[model samples]
Target: MAISGVSIFVVGIALLVSVPLSQQNEEVHLKFSYSGETGPDKWGSLKPEFSTCSTGKLQSPVNIVTKDVIYNPKLQPLNRDYRTSNSTLINHGYSIGLFYGSDKVGVMIHDGKNYTLKQVHWHSPSEHTINGIRYPLELHQVHIADDGSISVVGVLYNYGAPDLLLLQIKSKLDELAKEACGEDEIAKIPIGHMGTKYLRRGAFKYYRYVGSLTTPPCTQNVTWTIIAKVREVSKEQIEALTAPLEGSCKSNSRPVQALYGRKIELYNAMPNKI
Candidate 1:
C-alpha cells in the first residue's frame, strides 16, 4: 500500500553523481542542492508545484519543550524485523558509504490496516527543527502500512557525552566498505545487542507531519517524530561520519525550512508506560 499519493522511489540510474545512496537512484543517493540552482531553496523556484515548500504550512522539526498532552493513545506492537544482520552499505557521500545497523526493532504497531514498519535512515546535523533550533543528527525510522498511512520514530543526537553503541559503529565505520554485504550479510549485524532503552528514556517529545525528504526528488508522505533528547559524539566522531572521500561534498545536511501553517503536536507530555 502506498502512503502518500506520490509514488515511492525506486532503484534507478545513479543520480548520485557521487555516493551509492540506496540500490535505486531516487532512494537516498541523489545529490541535493541546499541553496541556489539545484539546491533546497531553489526546489520550489525550479517548479511551480514545489510552491508548497515556500508557501504551505505545517512544516516539520518542532522543538521539544514540555507541554500538556492529554490523550495517551494505546500503541500496539506488530511484527518486528530489527536485526544487526539487517545492516547494509549505501553510498551517501563521496567517501561515506557508511553502514546502517537496522534489525527490525519489532513492529511497535502494525496490522494489515494502517501503519507498518517500512525502513529507517539517518540525516547528519538533523533535517528537522525544534523550537527553531536544529540538532546534530536525526534518525528517521519510517513506517508505512496497508492503506497509505505513515509514522516515523525520530531519535535525536546532541553534543557532549557520547553513546557507546554509536561510538562502536563509528569505530567500525572505516570498515564500512568491507562490512558491505547483501541482505544475508546485513542479517548478521547485531541490533538487539545494542541498548535502545536510553533512546526512550526521559522527557521524550515528538513532532509529526506530512513532509517530504529534505533531499532531492523530495517526495512527501512522511510522519515525523523528532526526539527531544540528543546523543553525543566527539568532533572526531563527527569527522568520521562527514569526511568526504576524494571528490565529494563536505556536508550532507539540508537547511531548515521556515514553518508555514502546520500544527505541531507536543506528543507525550504525560509519561508513557513502557
Candidate 2:
C-alpha cells in the first residue's frame, strides 16, 4: 500500500539532528511516568529523541469531534485475519501488554497493504476521546507493515457487561498486577480465539487518520483507525485491569494532542448521511 510519508526511522534520525554530540552519546536514563517530574509534559526535555512528543504536528490521541469528520466512501472496511497464537503478558512499568510470537502472523489489510499484528496493549481511562467523552478503557492492537510502517486499531470500552474477549485474559491481568510489576511475565493465555471473535463483530465502523504513537519516541508514521463503536466491559473487569497497576502506573494515558488541521475520515459499512 502507498503510505504517505517518510519511513519512521528516517523521521527519528531527522529529529535527532537537533541534539548535541555529547548529549546524544550520553547514556540518558530517563524514566517517563503518567505524572510528576517525568510526566508527558517533560517528555521532550527528558530525552533528545523524544522531542517530537512536544513538537510534532501529527501527534495522536486527539479528541475526535464527529462534527469535524468527513464521511469517506472510498475508505475501505478493515479486513482482518487473525489466528489464535501463543501470547505473553508483560508489565512494562507503564502499561500491561499482551504479545504475540513473531512467527505466528495475523494481518490487517488497510489502504491496500497488509500490516501484521505485533502486540496488544491497554490504556486505562483511554487516550482517544470521542466528542470530548473518554471511555473507561481503550484497547490498542498494534500492527506493522513489512516496510516498518505502523497502523493501530483502537477499540474503546465503556462500563456495562463484561467483554468475553477481555474475560479470557482477566485472570492473567490480576496475576500480572499483583506479581508482575516491572517484569515481562508471560501469562499462559491463549488469545487467538478471543481476538478473532472480537475483531469480527459486525456493526462496527472506524475513523481513520495519520497520527503518532501515544508514547515517547512518539513516532508519527502511524495510520490510526479508531473504531467508532464502543464496546462494553463491566466495572469489575475495569478494576481487574487497573488495580494491579494502581500504585506505580495508576493512569498510563497521554493527554489529547492538537489536531493541526489533519483530516479524519469516518468509514461506514452502510451508506448514510453524515
Candidate 3:
C-alpha cells in the first residue's frame, strides 16, 4: 500500500507538470507593453526561455530613408481572392493586430504548385524598414506554400486619399475584434479589387529580409517583403486605430532596433510603363 501511494503521487505530479507545458508549446493570448513584466523591457525576461527576444540581433522595426535607386517594376505580386474569417484582437504587445484569414501564399499549378493565403495582420507606424526607412502603417499578408515555407508580402501605408477598402473595413473593426473569427463568417468582410490592387501596385521599393514577427513566439525563418510606397489614411483613421481599449491606452508598434549588420538589397531596375 505504501509503495502504491508513492507511485500514485508521482503520477499526479507528472500530469500536473505536463499539462502546462503542453499549453505553452502552443500559442497563447498575450498583451502588449513597453515597460515592465508585460512591457517591452520584459519581453526577453518573462521567462528564462524567451531570451531570443532580448539577444537575437536581427530584430525588426527598423528605420527607412529612401535611397536614390530604381526597382524591377515588372515583378508584380500575384492576385487571388484572400479569404478571411472572424478575427481575434491582439492589443497587449507590439501594435494592435486583428488576426484572421486562412490560406497561404505560393504558386498554384493545376498540375504544378499552389500557394494558399494563411493569415493577415497589421502594425501601426509600420514594422518594416525599406532601404532603412520606416512608414506609418504596414500590413502583412502572410501566406504558406504547399510545402510549409512562409512568404510575407508587406503593404506600407501613408497619408493620402482615403483607401476605399479601409473605408469599408474600418467601420466593422471594433466589432470584428471582439473575438477570434471562425471560418464560416470570414466572408463577412470582403477584400475587393481596390484592396487587391493596392497590394499589387503599392510600391516596389521593398526590402527582402530574413526576420521574425516583431511580437512574441518571435518565430524566425520568415521571408519578409516590405513595399516602399505608402497609401494614405485620414488622421481620423489613425486616431481610431490608436485609441485605447476598454482598459488600456498604448501605441502598438514595436520599438525600432539597430540594423545589427544585416545587408539590405534593392531590386535596382525601372518600373514598367502601364
- Estimated TM-score per prediction? 0.62, 0.83, 0.65
lDDT of 1 by residue, 180-250 (tens): 33211221122324433433344444444455545444445555555555667565665655552222234
Sort the predicted structures by TM-score, highest score first.
2, 3, 1
lDDT of each: 0.45, 0.72, 0.48
Instruction: Report the Cα lDDT for candidate 3.
Output: 0.48
Off by over 4 Å in 3: 1-27, 65-115, 129-134, 174-197, 244-249, 268-274
lDDT of 2 by residue, 1-274 (tens): 1122221111121122123423322222335777888788887887787899999999988999998898888988888888776677655456666766545458988789998776777888999999999999999888876677788889999989998877888777766656633332222333443455675465347899999888777879688999988999898887777665535457878999999989998898875644
Clashes of 3: 35
Question: Model 3, poorest ten-residue lDDT window?
Answer: 1-10
Tens-digit lDDT track of model 3 for 86-174:
44343322334434433222232211334454445555666665555556666776655545555566777777777555565675555
TM-score of model 2 relative to the true fold?
A: 0.83
Top candidate when judged by lDDT against the true structure: 2
